[model samples]
Target chain A: MSQPVRASLWAGLYCPGLPLSAVWDHQPGIGPVAVHSHQRGQARIFQAGRIAAQHGVRAGMGLSQALALLPQLQSRPRNPAMEQRALEQIALAAYGHSHQVVLAPPDTVLLEIAGSQRLRGGLQPLLDQLVKTLRQQGFRVRCGTAVVPAAARLLARVGQHADSPERLQHTLDALPIDALGLAPGKQQAIIGCGLRRLGELVRMGAPERARRFGSALNAELDQLYGRQPTPLAGWQPPERYRQRLELPVPSERSEALLFAGNRALDHLGGWLEVRDRALTALHVTLEREDAGNPIALGLSLARPGFDRARLLEMLALKLDRIRLPAPVAALVLKAETTLEHRPPQADLWDGRNHGDAWPALLDRLRARLGEEALSGIAPQADHRPEHAWRWVPPGTTRVCTETRPRPTWLLPEPRPCQRADFRLEDGPERIEAGWWDGQDCRRDYWIARDGRNRRVWIFHEHEPRSGWFLHGLFC
Target chain B: MPEAQPLQHLLDQRSDLWRGRRRPQARCTGSGRAELDAWLPDGGWPCGRLVEILPACLGSGELDLLMPLLAEQTRQGQPVMLIAPPLVPCPQRLHRAGIALDRLVVVRAPDQALWAAEQSLKSGVCGSVLVWHPRGRVDARSIRRLQLAARESDAPAFVCYRRHQQPPPSLSALRLGLEPGPQLTLLRGDGPTRALHLGRANVIELAVRRRQSASAP
Candidate 1:
């Protein structure tokens, strides 16, 4: 028989008591804590911390016994939602190193590192770095590597570190038959035959073991030894990116929050690249402790773009105007809109893309100065000088077809003027309308020259008490 | 003759330090007025510098004087930013005057107007900046800051104030008082000590050309 050469590498990361760890990380250094879960009509400690462990409170211990060991122990109910989210976060972090990451629910991850082992400098260094990073993220990680996925997971579960398929066989041989995850009756039946370790069980003929334990035991052994394929479903990143980051220090200034937001934005950039999309709108929710509601700032770009510098500039502009009600504890950034982007074609001869940057500049200005401040003029279909045009938001360009000359500046309200002080340069162009709206208008407008010869637009009332009123200025 | 010789000797002694003459820093942006351009150090409106225009009133045809230059800029797809305009600029008139409505940006808010103007000039995004009736008294320092900001982008900047509500003597390189004939009376700049009647027809011809080309397109 020829021995198969091990080539591909796989890593298994096992996280013990993740639910309790994820919660404890939020309030570290407070007190000894235990996570309790109800089982069989009695509450028991499902997970325990180092402090609780020192006091002899461990998993499966009755709640009463755990409390008896340490009277001041703080116990929190298990939160499965937070544990699930923490598992997803570990997967996301692993994505930075390799795309072939598979998540095993309730605390295990399988990473295919055959392609990335050399890129990461070697198997041992990569495993060490992965363990350190997981520990820093508040997870107790036990890692193992082997040629087969199941062997690596079993080795990590049994706290046996193996580096190669040749070494994995010895590590698996020592693990008891219970590591096969068979029914208890079947396990005891195998033990009744005096086969204690998995090596003894495998040495006993496979046909005899299969006939006694049903073919499942033989299949499990084949899978663990790399003889049979193990099915692993690869993880795919979620479509939308919504990341919340707790600031290291509580800040009362919005500008300070920007420093902490860069990490989240970097993650978002990676997420967008993976999805092959560009961001169009972003909504950032600033979480404050004292304030009842989180302050949300929404930025919409005129065109689909993924420029982080532009986003930071807009954020600075918004922060300049905002006075935080209280210190911000966290920031929740949600990408509200994204679009499929294609790279723009560069102009050849002049090397100038006309008006390509104007929209972005206008967007930045609107972000800083506000939408109302930047406006355009829309000519109204009216004859009164003041009603000739109205202020509209920027980018609204509806031109009136009238050829008559009009003033550029119009007063908010017309002022009564003494007609004798000015000379009428252009004769009256009559306008009488707006009767049904209750504000009746009957006026004869003219271009008048002031004492300083400045062009003034005025109108004389024809019906409702004859009077001259100044309204606009022609430039 | 002896006093003149002494003055000449003093001027020659400090030639390296003083240069003994005015070295023009203003780049031409074409004031749109022929006589005014001839009087200017450059043959036109100086670029990368602040030009203060004290209008006789709010509607003293100040915008008309700038229309040709703005139209030319907009024709090239360059933005023309109007900071804190006193009123809504009539779109029809601006369109007829050959200015691109898409390229025009009029900002309001009297308090933020100066800051907006400074940002617009410093950004190098706009081809020209016009701040109309900027509220509050501007000292020479603020004007100098605007000048420096304008110099960074080398875009022409104009700050218009009502003659009645004149600010303290500005440090603008070119300061003109807009008079009755829609004319320019140079109160500052390196020209004659007296007022000069700027030929309005030069810009008027430019505006006519813009209208013709714009209509053809």
Candidate 2:
């Protein structure tokens, strides 16, 4: 006896009401809604909500007829762009389940899960988790599994499942010829020939069927039953994430904007998660209602990571500082830059890790206090006291070889003073340099004590511009 | 002993209870000055605790007092943060004092000094944090927040108040008043309010005189 090899499995995710749901999901507590599009130059209902359907609104019905059937029916034009974006988002979500994802537009995502099934425990769990994730993202999803992509999509459209080859054969045999999704004229021709079930069509002689229905039907049947290969272009996740969410209502409150932005950020997090990348900078644009210029807020992180909570916190901080010029109608979040996420290596002995919090603290401080408010000081090899140091990013380390008895504090600018105001403690550490940068300074520096017994660095300029100036503190 | 069990339990639960004879050993980092360490209750600066330093005047050896602790921390590759110092910190001086200038983070949050200090302490990554609060504006509530944050993290936090500002009762673990002579008065801590000379001021003066004589000769 010969052993049978395991066939590859594909799962199809079908979203039946994508056109209507994609527009209605963000806006809550609205009346019955229906999506209408131009079909053969006549506006027809593409999809209708449950409430709208209850009032005799159906897909392919004229929009004027739907409104006439129920005067209170809310109708929106079908947005193909929005639907395409919605499909891509679902595909991005499915990419987390399996690396091989094929997107069938207008609303189907197919995933080859044979390789990843063991990692996800089993086929059923993977399908359940995928459906759960999509549902949580406010999409109505039905899943079906089969040995081939076309069969999986067909079963998903009919809300059926066929996991194994034997089951797939049984399911496809019982499915009617209508489920083949042939051209309308071809479907009618096949039905007219007394072909009621797919099992009968499969049992017919292949040459005769090909002669009667041309080679396309036989090829599709061969691909469906795994006899011929179904080559699909795999969908690759985009490098950048840009999601816009339409607000339910125009509101000027920052909390409202944040609430809408949180959804877009979730999608960004999911997109980044699949790519193993961290977002370093994000740009958010607020679409204003008054036709004014949109407000753009950019947040750059000190440490890059797809930490949703941290990003939200930073957004909240930015929102708290800005007064919205007008009520926002939509919120758009774009990932400006991303870095490959690398987890910090833990030390073998140290059980407690304190290194991770440093970057988070820096990010938080910069978010609230502005970027210029924090810096690390690096010593520069310059003779001028004021020019001897420069501001650097925090946590940067450099070696300084020059060791001199400089004051603990250098004043931003020297304050002119009378020489008699201070008692000289130490005299004449002359610094004459900076001629190259056109900031030449020739001053005699002294350590002096003021009336309050505080040590200060004072300087006396040479020649044409001479004055006693307090320069620094010895604290 | 059986009848006093409830009272003893209450005393143990209450952190404010002061036991005169029995002193609990606390986790500490040495101040690097023998005289000051001997005077401190914990034999050093208490770790994970807020220490409020009230200087008598600007440039009155406040930074000098913290120089040793900062140097020790930076040498160990731990970061030391200076939040809103009164003037620019000279990098050459810090390097000469054995402090790692690279590990020094200077935050200029003049209005949010206390908040930044609290966050730095709570982060636990910094070895030490020094925040210069505005004159007479350090409230008790903010101090309490800083104290709690410090207690939760290993970093020791120091809040420097302005000169001549009277020290209010705060939740600080240790409070010391500093003078130009580099003298320290233990304003609040485990021991009596005794004064101790820091011992470094005289050494600096002697070194200055020695350098002058060497140059004169």
The candidate scoring highest on TM-score is 2
Lowest summed lDDT across 10 adjacent residues in model 2 chain A is found at A338-347
TM-score between predicted and true chain B, model 1: 0.80
Error of 2 at B145 (Å): 2.0
True contacts kept of each: 0.62, 0.86
Q: For residue A463, give model 2's deviation from the true position in Å.
A: 5.4
lDDT of 2 by residue, A1-475 (tens): 8787767888899999899877765455677888888978999998889888887799999999999998988877877888888898899999998989999887899998988888768878888888898887878798888989988888888888787878989999999998887899998988888999999999989999999888889999988887888879999998777888777668998888777777788788788888878778998989999978999888887777766788889889888878887799888888866566766555578765555677788888888888888999888878787877889888777778675578888888888899999999888888888778888879999989888877889999883368999998887
Docking class of 2: medium
Candidate 1 recovers what fraction of true contacts?
0.62
lDDT for each residue of candidate 2 in B8-102, tens digit (9 for 90 to 100): 77776766678887765678988866667889888899999999898887777888888878877897888898999988888777877777776
What DockQ results do all the predictions give, each relative to the true complex? 0.47, 0.65
Best by DockQ: 2
Please give, as one word, the docking class of candidate 1: acceptable
**What local lDDT score does residue A206 receive in model 2, on the 0 to 100 scale?**
98
